[model samples]
Target: MRFPWVDYVVSGEADLLIGPLCWDILNRGRDIPPADLPFGVFGPAHREAGYPAASTRDLVPRAVIENMGDLPLPDFSDYFAELNASLYADRIHAGLPMEFSRGCWWGERSHCTFCGLNGGSMTYRQKPARQAAEEMIEMSARYGSSRIEAVDNILATDYLKKALPRLTALPEKLAIFFEVKANLKRHEVEKLAAAGVRWIQPGIESLDTRVLKLMRKGTSSAHNVQLLKWCRQNGVRVSWSLLWGFPGESDAWYAEMAPLLPLLHHLQPGPAVRLRYQRYSPYHYTAEKHGLKLRPAVSYRYVYPLSERDLADQVYYFEDSEDDDVGGHFAAGSANRRPGLSAVAKGIDAWLKAWYEPKLSMLSMRDSGDEIIVEDTRAIAVEREHRVRGLAREILLAADEGSPETRLREQLSGTNVMQAEIEAAIADMIARKLIVRLDARLVGLALWHPYTPIPPMTAFPGGYFDRRAAPLGTSRE
Candidate 1:
């Protein structure tokens, strides 16, 4: 309902069939008669003659599954057996699906403005770390596959403390994937790789801090960048996408953020897309609060003959009526939005295309104690290697987690680096796009050299901060 439902555009005559009117149906120990179930039937069932009348208001709320461990292992033997018997000769290496957690921890605190998922029950719950790890091993052994995928909305951070470490000690390696919040630190990414988590779907919807704020993403752009950088360095495949079109977002935000995309070619890039409104999301339920008027999307008309009012309850997709503009420029593709969006789109397309190219441009650095060497072969500043050994080098590395000039100065207290020198170095790095000045703080742009065990700097040929540096901001020819 969050993504694929928004993108589904095909048309055909069909009844929208919703499965069982049960949220915790699995919790029931025995099969209940249809008469005992809530009679909130839709489509054909309600249309049948002599339909039994039942009031949904009379039914009590189903209890949420308190102990996730109470659930038995999902039966996937049938799926594998069917696959083996099918005409297809090749055996599919299936990633056994499992869930040790329910709801979203982040959502319970601050639901993303555009997220409509887990609306029915947003309370976060998870199995004990040991229980979760045991299931992973048992499922793999039972299903005869080392690949596993967690269907949980977010990876339980508790696993990093114990479960992942336990898996890391196993004799046989297992490939695992999960959706994680992108505010992960370097060691966490390393731990994930060590535990055989080869893939991750991180929630990094936008690169601009202001844009991310509109959706309450609870992560800074620098944090997201660090996650992407750390994942790439640790051999973890990241799955993410960039979204735009928030109601109060400024086109200038995109314009300002687009230039940094090329600086990130070494890292994976996800799709750049427009924001969509979905049922249960804040935008849909409380439209006027965000300066929007909701209506069923035009595509819905193709499926149902009912009026918009009748479709309101059944439909999940929606469109906003606060168009032609809002608060100056807020239309889907407003005039002010195009130039910035075009710039971002072009950059994203190039970033994605580079993965297919034989020689992709990258900005990487290796630490050599106090000295740092940077290799820049990005869309811009591809002239040479950067060598930094003094105050500039100190400032560049100190800002890795994003720090204000005052903090950089404070962190380097009693050092040879002065406040003036720190300011100059940060300005120079921002100009070179070697580091970004985001939200009044400096974040080091170069990823740590993959082969380096500790902090190191890298420079290709023309250094940005060193004395023998070429002119800064040299665009690659």
Candidate 2:
């Protein structure tokens, strides 16, 4: 029995049984058998009769890289570049996700008590600005990926300033997205906007100063507000992170910060102001330094240490306090409470679809696919439908199709099938590798001569050829 790589084990396939090895068992020096693997080690476990055995021991190694010296940083950039090249090599791949840097800038100074970085130690590095920009350009050329998502913990303002010139030189058609500290200067915001940076995720953990201090966040509430205002003024979309409970927080603090909701609404409403609660996790150094202790973790609905004003505010806002004591509530309503793993995943999915994918596809169209008109139209349709559906299905479907054409077609067909029942009949034909383009030529008129093919249907034995020949139907055309 071989152990599966971490990715394969967590990928959620039934036949994909993952087991531990003798080395792993010996490393932990435990008498426990590898067969006793814990269910829900990666995530949730079903409470059914038969649960798969998973190791209860910690299997992952925790190490922080301060400096590689002679050893070079693994060129994950090249790996990702190749990955995107393969993905977008045909039908203009929109919303391609990329990260220019990793971890947080504050990691160099004071680690956020909640973050897990540098193997739970604080760390930071400045990726070469030119290298990062060139990578984006290469990705665009190779995969026609116009949208770039820089999944850094927080892209330091100074780094952005240095990277701005390089980013400004990128194709105007390309859109960039990244996270930043909420204390960006006015000039920094302007420079980012000028550089085609469209989406900004700011860590505005809380409006309460005490909470910010507790989290070891250096930025002030005033600074967060100023940055948001500046970003909004420059037409930059701000996606902010709001955290709620810290150890010393009480009902009064929550009430005091409640007014920040309207301010956030005024700054950037709807999905733009993403609020999330982060339960404090005490790592070795921070725990020892602050003498912090972990509260017994509870389920999503567990409400502990309740208060009257907190309950009243919950009722007044028509929001149900999450059963667990995690903080941050979206301004839209308390009904949007997300206190569990599933909700966090859904939120991330929504963000990628809405802000990241289309732009990436637009940038990477050249390397991924032929410049055929049919494929172009198909890509455009897929992108448009993705915007309407909020990009959730596209991200999910992208996980399935390996070929560029298949992925693009699957996305379009899946989106169309969701929007209209009429498209259901043709969806299977589009999914199976049977048909590739639709013939839309009349006797002499060839307005639709180069129509992309739809998948073949078993219901129509003649390979669904006649169905494609019928009078042109109403399309997104």
Which candidate number would show the highest TM-score if scored against the true structure? Answer: 1
Winner by lDDT: 1
Model 2: runs farther than 4 Å from truth? 1-93, 156-158, 171-173, 269-477
Residue 430, candidate 1: Cα error in Å is 2.9
- Model 2 residue 147 CA deviation (Å) reads 0.6
lDDT of 2 by residue, 1-477 (tens): 112222122222121123343344456533333244333323211222233543311233222333322222223456556645774333322444655454566756776656543332334554567666666677666655466667667675555757678768655545777777776776787787777776777777665566777778887655555555456556577655555534454545555544333223224432322222222223322444543432333332256344443332222111113334233333334433423322433443353453333332210111112221211222223332111122322322332222244445465666554534324423432342112221110000011222222211211111112333433222111
The digit string of per-residue lDDT tens for model 1 on 4-91 reads 2231111211112113433324455234344444423322222333234332221313235556766778888788799778654142
Q: What is residue 189's positional error in candidate 1, in angstroms?
A: 1.4
lDDT of 2 at 255: 53
**TM-scores of the models, in the order given:** 0.80, 0.45
State the C-alpha lDDT per candidate.
Answer: 0.71, 0.43
